[model samples]
Target: MPREGLEVENLHLWRGEHHVLRGVGFALPRGGCLHVTGPNGAGKTSLLRAACGLLYPESGRLLWDGRDVHEDLPTFHSVLMYIGHEAPLKADLSARENLRYWIGTRRRIGRDTLGAALQRVGATAWSERPARTLSAGQRRRVALAALSLLLVPLWLLDEPTTNLDAEGQQLVGTLIEEHLARGGLVLAATHHELPLPRSRVQRLELTHE
Candidate 1:
C-alpha cells in the first residue's frame, strides 16, 4: 500500500549562486499541519513554493501518497493550493470580484459561495470595496476568503498572519483547524507563531546555512 499524505525527500534548491534549501525532508500524514518558521532568507518561502511546484528544486522529490509529484504536475496541482507572501488580488477589482476571478481559475464558484467565504473570514463587510482601498489586514482576510473557497487537500501558505490583529489571527487558526478536521493538510511559513493548538502542529525551523 502507498504511504498516505505528503513527503519531501532530499530537497536541494539553488537560486543562482546561493543555495537555499539544503537536503530538507519531512513527512506529513492526513489531518497534519507543518509550520515552517525561520528568519528572513532562511528559505521558508522557497520551500513552500517548491513543494507546490511553482519553483523547481535542483535536486529533490515531492511525494503525495508515495508517488512523485513531478510525474503528473497537473494532477498534483489539482489537489494543491499555494498562497504566497503577497495576496494575489487585483488592485482594480473589488474584493468580491477578486474572489470570483481567483477561485474561478481552479473551479466554478457562485456569488453565494463567495459571500459565505468572505463572511467566514470577516471580510464580507467590505467585499464590494476595491482591493486597493482595503487595509493590509483586510486584504489578508480577502486572501483567506479565497483560500476557503478552494476545496483542495494541501495548502501552502507563506506568512498567513502577516497583517492581522489578534482576532483575525485567531480566525486563521480556526480556519486551519477546521480544514485539518476535514482531513486536509496545511504547511504554513510564518515569522510569528501561529495561534494553533500545539498538539496538531508539527514545527520545522529552518536556518541560514
Candidate 2:
C-alpha cells in the first residue's frame, strides 16, 4: 500500500458557537484527489483550511505524512500549498513578476521557469501587464500560474476553477493530473467537475443540522 497522504480525526471547529465541522475523519491517500462539496456554510472550505494549518480546530488532530503537523510545521508546510477563494496576487506587479517572486522567494523553483508557467496558463499574452489591469479571469490565470512553481507533494485548493473559461479549466485539470502522476495529493473544494481521465476522486458532502 502507498503511504498515507494526510489524516484528520474528530475534527471539530467553531466560530463563536457555530459548529462547522463535526467529528470528521478521513485519510487522503498518496496520489489521490479528494473533492469536497457542500452547500454554502457547510464547512468545506473550513475543513480545507484546517488541514492546511490556517485555522486551528476546536478539537481533533491533523497529520501529514504520518506525523503531527503542528509538531513540525516547517517541514509539513514545505510540502504543501494552499490556494484560497480569493486570488493571492499583487496588483502592482506584472504577471511575470508575480511568478518570479513566488518562485524565487517562496518556492525556489527558479525564476527562469516563470515565463514557461505563464505560457502554459495562456497568460503569456499579458504576462507583462500589471495584475490590476487584467480581467478577473486573466488575474486568476496569473494566480494559477504560481502553482506551476510549486514542487510540493500536497495541494489544498478552494474554488480553484472560479473565473476560468472552458479551455482554462481544461488546462488546470491537466495540471492536476500531472501532479497526481508525480505522486502528489490534492484536496480540492470545487463546485465543478474536473476534466481528467482515470482520477481517484472522493466526494465529501457536509451538512449542518
Candidate 3:
C-alpha cells in the first residue's frame, strides 16, 4: 500500500458536550478521492471542519502526508483548500472583483490569470455583476473559479454541486477529474450523486446512535 495522502486516526468531535463524531478513521492515497455521505446532523460537516483545522478535535489526530496538520497550520493550509457549504464571496463586490480581491489577499495567483479563471467558470457573462445580483449558482462558480487559480493539492469541498444546473454539475465533475489526474486529493461531502468514477472513490457514512 502507498503512503496515505490524508488520514484521521480515532477522530472524535463534539458540540456543546454533545458527541458528533465517534472514532472516525480513514486514509486516502495521493491522487485519491473520498465522498462522505450521511443524513443531516451526521457529523459530515464537522468531520471536514476538523480535518481542515477549522475545528479542534476533542481527541484524535489529523495528518496530512504523515505529518500532524495542526502542528503547522500554515504549511498544511498551503497544500489544502477548504470550501464550505456557505459561499465565501463578498456580496457587495462583483464576481470578478471578488476573485481579484481574494487573489490579491492571498497573492496565490498572478494578475494575468484573473480573466482566464473567470472565463473558465463561465462567469464572463456576469463577471462584472455584483455577487448579490447573481444567482446562487453563479456565486458558487465564482468561488470555484477562485479555487482553480490556486495550486493546492488537497481540496475539501462541502456540497460543491449545490445550486448548480446540469451543465454546472458536469463542469464541476470535470474539474474534480482533472484534479485527481494531476495527483491531487479531494474529500467532498455531498447529498447528491456526482458523475465521477466510483472505483477511485470510497463512501463513508456517519450516523447517530
Candidate 4:
C-alpha cells in the first residue's frame, strides 16, 4: 500500500460566535507526524475534527491525495482512524468484548489478534475485565488497542497520552513510531511531547484571536 497524504488549506472555523481557527494550513506526507500545540480554546481539537470530516469548516478544504475528502466519504473514512479525547468504549463490556464489538466480524480478526493488540498496550492481563472496572489509564489503553487492529493510513488523535503513566506513555510513543515506519500518517493534538522522530515530525501551533 502506498502512503497517504493530507493537506489542509486556509481552514477557518467558528464555535457559535467565536472564530477559533483562522487560515490554518499544512501538509502531511506519508510516514509523517504533525503535532498540534496550543493553550486552551485554541482550536486544536476543532482542526482535527475538521480534517476527519467530523466538523465542517466555514471555509477551506481538506484534501487526501490531491482530492477533496468530502468528495468520497467512504474512501476517506476507510483510510483514516480518529481517536478523540474520550475513550470511546462501552463501560459494560470487557476489554476484549469492546474490541470485538468495534472491529466487528466483517473484518475477520480472530481472538488471538485482539489479544495481541491488548498485549501491545499492556492490557492483556485485564482483557476480561469490564471497561468500567478499569482505571482511567487502563481504559485509555483499551481504546488505543484499536489502533493495532485497524490498518488505516491516517490517524487523528487528540490528547493520546491523557491519564497514562510513564510506561503507558512510552507505549503510545512506540506504537506511533512503528506506525510512521510503515508509511502511515499521524496528526495529534497534545500538550506533552511524543516520541516522534524529528525528521518525520511537523508542528502546528494554534492561537486564539
Candidate 5:
C-alpha cells in the first residue's frame, strides 16, 4: 500500500520582511480533516494557498500520495478543489451561468446535477440571479454549490462559513461530512470551529511569527 494523503513538512513563508509562517507542518490522510486555526495575520490562508500550489512557500515540501506536488502540478490540481474566501463567480454572470461556465471547463455536469447542488445549498431561489445581485450569504451558497459540482478528492477551503448564518453554517458542516464520508480530504482555515467529531479532526494552530 502507498502513503495516500497530503503532507506539508517544515513549511516556512515570508511576505516582505515579516515571517508569516515558521516551520508549520502536518500530514492528513484520506477521510482526514485538518483545521488550520490562527488569528488574523497568522498565515492560515497562506498555508492553505501554499499547500494547493497557489503560492510557493519559501521552504517546504508538499507531497500528494507520497509524490512531490511540484513534480506534476497539473496532475495534483486535477484532484484538488480550492475554495477561497471570495466566491469565484463573475459579477455579471447569473449564478447558474457562472456555475455552468466554471464547471463546464473542468468536467461534464448535467442540468439535474447542477440544480440539485444549488438546491442542496439552499440557493435555488436565486439560482438565476446575477451574482452581483446576490447577498454575501447567497454568493457563499453559490460557491458551495460549485464545490458540490467539482467532485474532487481534496478540498482546500478558506473561511468556508464566511457570511453564512447559523443554518447556512450547519449546511456547510453537512457538506463536509458527506465529502469526508467519501474518503475526501479537507484543509480548512476558519475562525469558526467546524461541527465535526474530535476523533476525525486534526488541529494545527499558528501564531504571530
Candidate 6:
C-alpha cells in the first residue's frame, strides 16, 4: 500500500469578499493525525475543504504524494474520506441501507463486514432503524460506521463529535486511534478535545483574517 502523505502550501481562500484561509500550510505523514482548532469565523472548515479538493484555493496548492490533488482528482478522492458536520444519510433509508449505499459506491462489502462495522461504532442496535427516526448521536454513529466499512488512507473530518455523548465521543477517539495505527492519516476540525494520544497527533490553530 502507498503511504499517504498530504502537504498544503501557502493556501489562501476567499469566501465572498472576505479572505478565509491566509497562507495556511501543513504536512501530515502516514499514521499521523492533525487536530485543527480555532474560534468561529476562523478558516478551519475552509482549510479542510481545500485540502480535500472540495474547495479551490485562491493561491497555493494541496498535494497528495507531492503531486497537486486537482491534477488528478479521481485518484485523490478514491483514497480520501470526508465527513463534515452534517450526516450524509437519506432520511428514508435505514442505517444499514445507508451504509450499504455508500459502500456500494466504493467497493463490495459482505453482510458480516457491515455488521461488524455497525457493531464497532455502537450503532448495531439501531442499524435497522430509519435514519430520520434516530437521534442526532445515533445518526452520527451511523455515519461513523461507514469508516469501518472502508479503508481510505486520508480522512478529513469536520466536528466529528458534534452530536455524540461521552460514549460516542470515546468511540470517535477509538476509531481515530485504530486508523492511525494502521498508517492512515487524519485531519479533523473540532472545538472539543479529541482523545488521541499526543505522540501521533499534531495541533494546528487557525485565526480569522
The reply for model 6, stretches above 4 Å from the true place, is: 1-4
Q: What is the lDDT of residue 163 in candidate 5?
A: 94
Winner by TM-score: 1
Model 4 / residue 67 / CA error / Å: 0.4
Candidate 6 — worst ten consecutive residues by lDDT sum? 1-10
Tell me the lDDT of candidate 2. 0.83
* Tens digit per residue, CA lDDT, model 4, 42-137: 998999999999898999989898889998987898898898898878999998999898877336788889888989899878899888899989
lDDT of 1 by residue, 1-209 (tens): 99999999999999999999999999999999999999999999999999998889999889999999999999999999899878988989999998898889889998788888988888877888899999999999988988899989999999999889999999999989999999999999998988898888999999997
Question: Each model's C-alpha lDDT?
Answer: 0.92, 0.83, 0.86, 0.88, 0.91, 0.89
Best by lDDT: 1
Model 3 residue 2 distance off true place after TM-score fit, in angstroms: 9.3
* Alpha-carbon runs more than 4 Å astray in model 1: none
> How many backbone collisions does model 4 have?
0
lDDT tens digits, residues 81-155, model 5? 999999899989999999999988999989999999888898888898888899999999988889989989999
TM-score, per-candidate, Cα-based:
0.98, 0.94, 0.95, 0.95, 0.97, 0.96
Worst 10 residues of 1 by lDDT: 118-127
lDDT of 4: 0.88
RMSD of each: 0.8, 1.8, 1.6, 2.0, 1.0, 1.8
RMSD of candidate 5 to the true fold?
1.0
Q: Which one wins by TM-score: 3 or 5? A: 5
Query: lDDT by residue for model 6 over 1-209, one digit each (tens)?
Result: 43349988899899999999889999899888999999987988888888889898899978898888899999999999998888799999999999999878998998999999999888878899888899988988987898767899999999999989998988889999989999899999987888776776799999875
Residue 88 of model 3 has an lDDT of 84
- Which scores better on lDDT, 1 or 3? 1
